[model samples]
Target chain A: MRIWDPSIETLDRVSLRQLQLTRLRETIDRAYHHVPCYRSKFDELGLGPGDFRNLEDLRRFPFTTKEDLRLNYPYGMFAVPMKEVVRIHSSSGTTGKPTVVGYTKKDLESWAQLVSRFMTAAGVTDEDIVHIAFGYGLFTGAFGLHYGAERIGASVIPMSSGNTDKQIMIMQDYRSSALVCTPSYALTIADRMEKTGIDPATLALKVGLFGAEPWSEEMRRELETRLGIVATDNYGLSEIMGPGVAGDCLERCGMHIAEDHFIAEIIDPETLESLPFGEWGELVLTTISKEALPMIRYRTRDITRLHPEPCRCGRTHVRMEKTRGRSDDMLIIKGVNVFPTQVEEILFQAEGCEPHYQLIVDRQDNVDSLTVEVEVNDQIFFDEMKLQRIFIQQLEKKLATGLGVGVRVKLVEPSSIPRFEGKATRVIDRRSR
Target chain B: MKVEQISIFIENKSGRLAEVSRVLGEAKVNIRALSLADTSDFGILRLIVDRTDEARKVLQAHNFTVNKTEVVAVEVPDRPAGLAEILQILDDVQINVEYMYAFVERCSGNAVIIFRFDNVDEAIAALLGRGVNVLKGEQVYEL
Candidate 1:
């Protein structure tokens, strides 16, 4: 197995913690002094950078939630000024505001390096052609993996997401070796190849680096068999540095967190208390080396357990199990994070639409589809069938535009959707994998 | 003369159409004429019933999305070009027929056709002016 940076990845526990302590202190100072959000948070707790005597003392600080990022809006959480920032990425929020993160020149360099570590561990080499299927732009998955592959001196074919037929065409013509995309998308490509009577064995694909959505071991096996490639899972989020935060090292036991750059913590989501190794809990990460945005104990909401035991592959960083599930009700459809509230917001704004609605998510033919079922009311109902269809289609268009993904709006009879007592069950996810 | 037509929205699933019919049947509503328009996802069941308001109220009570629309019923000449002549008369006056369906019962030995037009009043005026018999709401309901 290959390790991108041996000095950091395979550092001894004593030395790694020493490095983490030093970086943690520096990050704390930078965040407390520069970012107003962190500054006030530390001030409210009556703490400062000087109080950090050791790694354990770092827990006294407050945890930053996604709401904090929204509160700050675009650039309020950055420790550096806009002039020093070079790149920007954001995740779509439940409402209109997105959680944005910026990167300085050095930050971007470290990001690529971090990403390269995981891709390298997943068997991507300079001789291999890396085909990235994640869409580029505000979403960090594509650009993060793109730069990381480039850093490894790999020939990158930037085939951004969608156009599955074209993706297969490029894969065949370009003779690409490594496939980078969501696991479901890879399956979609496999389905396309099968329908077109193309054999997977004829392709040159050797490894697949799949992420951005939770997939199963069964799906991994299915993808491996159909695509004839070694499928591996990588984990990351935009709030932290994207894609390179952790990944499997061919061992496939768990994804090794880039502990040198991030300080990973498992905490009970309800009590906000830290959990022991091998216990399932919400993953919280504090950016120790990030320059533009120094995140302090950001709750990832991803539920997983950490394995502190050393792997046969020789990396010392703790390995996290594939995220069992999320601590929240956010749904990942086609790798895009969608909150039920986001769907509700759009439905509420639609005139004559009842507040009663449900979101049905199902994976059909390896592609995720969202169907928004809304209860029909007199205000929106039309006497003519043609007018009713047009109304429903207009609502579908509005939801698609608002959600950034295709959605089918289904009109149900009045009061058909069951009314719940307290928290409403708004989402019905039938995706088996 | 304008006639009342009830339209019910039904999801395209097994037993939905049967459920609508069962509800209307239990309410003792007499269906005079009927048409079904459908897409892959859903269907709209349109009916000219003996009592439009009562049928709609009953369907609504049963959680069906029911709507009432004003359509016109015209007596078509019972010959080969009976329906064509009525349509041509409306088209000559530039009246658009949104949709049309046939009634089961006939009036004065002529075929009674239910027509939903974009402009109901104008369609009735054009047909009545051409000596066409436009059945009143009561007459169609009785037939």
Candidate 2:
């Protein structure tokens, strides 16, 4: 029921569109005059900043991709000087070169404000103690949430990732009311609690804001029941202002996008054509209010839909559904597109299956095969070999039916699968290898 | 009639069995009787050790999936058809033997065999009803 900065959040559509148009023109001029990459892109289209008449004209500009950012490397995409830029953050660059982003002093202020909006919407108040588990480094997830919680005037414990036992101890000692980390890490905490016989009812946790990875609704239920906290989903990417791009209100519906700061669009990935509302497609965002990194229709590569209807919480901003998965992370097996979260949904429904699992895809004799390696715990382990075999057979059958493709299930010991402190890596595709 | 045994789940990779053995050996737990059942991917190493609790503790401390089970150990006559005669009695009573393995040492001049049955209590009663000698947990552990 609470709204942060209702003046901007509750603005009428007509006034919001007008504000976006004015900001879009300034962003275009800044990018075209300062950044060489944007200038060349504009030159190639023979278009100038003066040609923009309305919002529909944004589609004419060339879309920016992660590959383009990497091609420019560090500082090539910045629209301001180094002295004006106060802080710098970057992607992990696991695939290739890490794409660098810089933020000016004003940019940091806006970043905190944007994050504060979502934090308040998720039911955080100044009386709450926020415990952040995201790692602090070149990655933006931790710092993004850190400043946001500070902006809300709440007590913050910057307990950066790992040391699950210590994390639980501090959560109990500090009486943290707000938890910030990826959804998978929350499950890891729940697992450690079960192993140590720490009851969730004794903890003071109230709300959990999880992001940086795709998780299923079933996982939300699992976390809520196991941790005795209300779990909410938020969406953001390092390429665009990190954690505060959009978040859920107390209504527990889709996340409301910060349309006042950034413009969101959905387009078919293969054809690059715009799609209607309520249709699933790749997300494209353009930072209209950014001063340093003025992205023009940057391809987010995340797949989700948008709901234009007003939410019950009284915010008029359009809400975007939780992304199914990133376009790049989707696996193609036997010509069927599969997302890891879909596999997660099925595993959570099974009684004895743990939340920890890894999908290993390999090619043998020019055929693709998927092997889901699940962790074996006390509940799933059987002393009798016959019962064990029967349990595995039943799991394999369930997985095959749920996945629509035959899969082999391999059971490993508990804590065998590597637990991630940040974003969880759930897939290993060896077809290219 | 029901003897304590530890069953460990181990992957079928080289050095795994040796590692489990090294842990138990370093803990000074003597293996009285043991059997290994393996598939292509993993194996279950079942052991009746001189110290069941210590062996399970050491194996688990070394990160092996260890579980405790109760199995029936019987004293078999040392003749050629001695094992078959005891199994025939179990079969006549409709009690199924899941798995059976021979022990390393003899008990009172008879061959000792460890049997894991579907119904452990029923198999023990059937063997005892046929006048067969059944070893207790301490008798098998100290053999």
Model 2 lDDT at residue A174: 94
Which window of ten consecutive residues has the lowest lDDT sum in model 2 chain B?
A: B36-45
- Give lDDT tens digits, candidate 2, residues A62-109: 999877787888889999998999989876332334669989998899
Model 1 regions more than 4 Å off: A195-199
* Model 1, TM vs. native: 0.94
Cα lDDT listed for each candidate: 0.91, 0.85
DockQ category of candidate 1: medium
How far residue A235's Cα lies from its native spot in candidate 1, in Å, is 0.6
Candidate 2 CAPRI-style tier = acceptable
Candidate 2 structure lDDT: 0.85
DockQ of each: 0.62, 0.23
